[model samples]
Target: MTAVKIIKVLGTSEESWEDAAQAAVEEASQTVDDIHGVEVEDWTANVEGGAITSYKATVEIAFPVHESSGDA
Candidate 1:
């Protein structure tokens, strides 16, 4: 059986939830490969002047951890 691993990340943006979510995936992609998917487990925002000033996204990024080839 293959081992599975999971990690949680919080990515925020002043724009929208999509951006916040994308931010997380993009960052994770830099180091983690073969990202299966990202789930918006939770979300919150900062309100200012009766409007959303910032958006925060709680994402569950799931991916497989593979052994490094070490063929540098």
Candidate 2:
């Protein structure tokens, strides 16, 4: 059996929506393992001087939960 978990995270980038989503997954991987997939829930932007200064992405990261040795 496989156990999974989902976490919501926010990431921003000056590049594009893809970069923002990638950044979120990269940052999460620093502390998380077995990353399965990412679902982009929402997108927004920071506007400055009639231009988009930054792109923001809200993602749901999914990963497998490892079982402890003591599990019965």
Candidate 3:
């Protein structure tokens, strides 16, 4: 049987929200494999000196769960 797992991740960037979202995916890819898709759940930002300092993205990452083969 094949299964998919979804997890929420937060990414931050000093640029645009798009970049923040991409950052999330990239970071997740470092640990997770076979990433099929991502959904941006929310968007947020931080303000410093009355200006937008950074962007934050809340994303849901989806990947297939690999079953371990009976090799041991």
Residue pairs in collision within model 2: none
Order of candidate numbers by TM-score, starting with the best: 3, 2, 1
**Per-residue accuracy of model 3 over 1-72 as CA lDDT, tens digit each:** 779999999999998999999999999999999999999999999999999999999999999999889799
lDDT of 1 at 9: 86
**Per-residue lDDT of 48 in model 1:** 89
- Please, what is the whole-model Cα lDDT of each candidate in the order they appear? 0.86, 0.95, 0.97
Model 2 misplaced regions, further than 4 Å? none
Candidate number with greatest lDDT: 3
lDDT of 1 at 56: 87
Q: What is the C-alpha RMSD of each candidate to the true structure, in Å?
A: 2.3, 1.9, 1.0
Model 1: ten consecutive residues of lowest lDDT? 1-10
TM-score, one value per model: 0.82, 0.92, 0.93
Off by over 4 Å in 1: 68-72
Which has the higher lDDT value, candidate number 2 or candidate number 3? 3
Backbone clash tally for model 3? Answer: 0
